[model samples]
Target: MDAIEKNLLKEVAELDSLPVGAYNIRANGQLAGRNTTANIDIVTKTDKPGIDIYIRPFTKNESVHIPVILSQTGLKDLVYNDFHIGEGADVTIIAGCGIHNCGGGNAEHDGIHTFWLAKNAKLRYVEKHYGEGDGRGKQIMNPTTIVHLAEGAEMEMETTQIAGVDDTIRKTGGDLAEGASLVVKEKIMTTGDQHAVTDFNVDLNGEGCSANIVSRSVAKDESKQEFISHINGNCACAGHSECDAIIMDHASVIASPALTANSVDASLIHEAAIGKIAGEQLIKLMTLGLTEKEAEDQIVNGFLK
Candidate 1:
């Protein structure tokens, strides 16, 4: 192996030896010094399951970027995983998981992620979770993500969840500091006999802090989806939250979006809607020579676009 490859393997071995809990990435040779910058790419073996990751700044003013990819081959249960982003540093992280297992057995996965954006820092995170059909009874996933922003810091987070075997529950939230801002967007799609729930909460704790949340979900067959979003302004902050869902063919959806402002100077607004696709649009597409299924698919594709 090359020098870099050997070093990386050594680091991974060291991390594997640590106890199961939160530990700084620096301890594993994944982090550079404070005020420096580093990039990390991770690809795990198929079906290995459990992994716990913690990211923290070695010193103030550091910057780090991480990209992670997961494959479904040899899939096993992922009991718990954690991600931590430290204060006073900028971090950009991208993560995605896909299941390609063809066996007919149930699976369960859970994850917890935390972000601490210090003063004058920033964080941008994007995550996609998807599962493939295996004719299994139940496949469950529960994920929770939390973010804390300090003065002048900002966070931008986006998530996409696509249904696979059975039921999935995902929860995410964050707190914004003075002059900080947070923007979150989520998209969910499900089919078959699946059940999914997504929850989001945002707190604006300092003056001039703001937040924006947008969520959309689509369910088909006997599937069910629920979306809940809340935005709270504790001091003098301003923000808005919007949620909408589309249901079809015996599918059901529930949407709840709320905005609360504790101080008079704070301004918050929220809106939520749940319904099916407009029949007129479908009919129009069908008249264009598309089959019923094709028209429906077109509408869904357009909605997500």
Candidate 2:
């Protein structure tokens, strides 16, 4: 890997070098490196431009890193990565994409990730998206995620996209079985003339199934953002979704949340809040000797964290 790729990896995945466990690195739409352990296997799909990851049953305390980087001009890369986790396994998956386009042509990467967790399995997934370049063209990313949790399974997801991307559309959906649970937290920031949209849909179809989804975002300058979430409880299930955003300058934010309950015992809730930073928050920080910009940055940082 070159210095640019290394820097991008550090920014997106916080990796100083190749990880110690199972991993795969993709750059410029091709495989750059790969390693698999005895309990986990990574295989490339012959019919697609992505890999399939398999974790054996009863495996625990292991992790996998699959990060993609793009440095080419006028390049559009699309990949489909699927994960199959065995029963009773507990593991973590780190995946993200970074792009550097320094030309007049646009650069884009679209990734679709699907996960299947067996009974009693637990998974922790993290994904980050970033873009950087001094170019006239745009940096665009569209990511879609699908999850399926079996009975007694659980999955927790953390996703963030803080800066540099010019345009993005993110979509996530999940289905939970009996006694299954799903939790998702997302953070995003947009500045300049950038635009971002997020959509989340979750279904709790079995008794005792539950889901919670939350998103926090900041829009600054002339940027625009939209968030839509839908939670459906079919059978004695519980679901909740929330969206919180801060708008600044001429930026605009729209949040739409929907909840549906088909069973009498099902419970669902949706909440959304969008507004500018409180003047008192800035004044309090300023009294502590911080500049106005610094105070605003600190507040936004803490809110997202």
Candidate 3:
């Protein structure tokens, strides 16, 4: 193993000795790296900090599952740099960002994540971005995630964003092999003058492959959110994509779902809708003796369903 990988293994061993909950690690002007057969949970806070994380299982038929959590904090811009997961590995990763700056300054974060799942492998991943109680911090987050699935592999991913006084952009893509399947769920909630854009794409490259994408967003109080979803069905594959949004009280939202079929035998479908909570529905619920707040909550809940 290289020096960086060895140093990472040592750092992880030290961290594992700590409590099981979440802990913050300061990588101030430091470089961290990990190699095969290493499972780590890391949280970084610094500027231009680098982390090279890799995971690869030992046996061919045997599967190993690794869980990872990444978080960002502080006023300076932090780069939670490149991460890679090898082929034929079962992995679950959760990555999130939170900026709690009471001052009137700005913060920025950038991340890149990549995964390669070999034949007959499975991966479940979740990503979230949230900012709370902002004072004037102009937070910018750019996250790019890519996945490659081999034959008979499966990947399920969910991404959520809640930004206040921040602007975020997220891009994700996946490539599937024969008989592979991929499912993606994206959710965004924005309030207090936030702006966000998200793009998702999936390509099926083999027969009997499938892909599905579902996107939902809620914007309120001058917040703006835009989402674009693309599903490409190639080589006699099947896929579906859907995007939906709800806007309220001077809020704005745009949703576009697109599907492209490259082969004549491929089956693909896409749908998108943008609207607000119906006042008539709320009134009907209120007439049944429910409070106004309760009625409005019910309407919002039903729309999400």
TM-scores, each model vs. reference: 0.75, 0.99, 0.76
For model 1 the TM-score comes to 0.75
Which window of 10 residues has the lowest lDDT sum in candidate 3? 62-71
What ranking of all candidate models by lDDT puts the best one first? 2, 3, 1
Predicted candidate 2 versus true structure: per-residue lDDT over 1-305, tens digit per residue: 88888988987889998998999999999999999999999999999899999999999999999999998979999999999999999999999999988999899999999999999999999999999988588899999999999999999999999988999999999999999999999999999999999999898987899999999999999999999988888999989888999999999999998898889999898888999999999999999999999999999999999
For candidate 1, what is the lDDT? 0.64
The alpha-carbon root-mean-square deviation between model 1 and the true structure, to one decimal in Å, is 8.4
* Candidate topping lDDT: 2
Better TM-score candidate (2, 3)? 2
Better of 2 and 3 by lDDT: 2
* Model 3 C-alpha lDDT per residue in residues 1-305, reported as the tens digit of each score: 33333333233222233223322222322332322333433434345454444445422332222222222234454455443445556666545554444456665556666666677766677666655444655666677888888888888887766444378888888899999999988877777788888888888898999998888878878998888878887788989888888888899887777788789988998888888877888889999999987987676666554
Runs of candidate 3 exceeding 4 Å displacement: 1-49, 58-88, 163-165, 288-291, 301-305
Q: Model 2, which residues run further than 4 Å from truth?
A: none
Segments of candidate 1 deviating more than 4 angstroms: 1-91
Q: Please report, as a residue range, the 10-residue window in candidate 2 with the lowest summed lDDT.
A: 130-139
Whose TM-score is greatest here?
Answer: 2
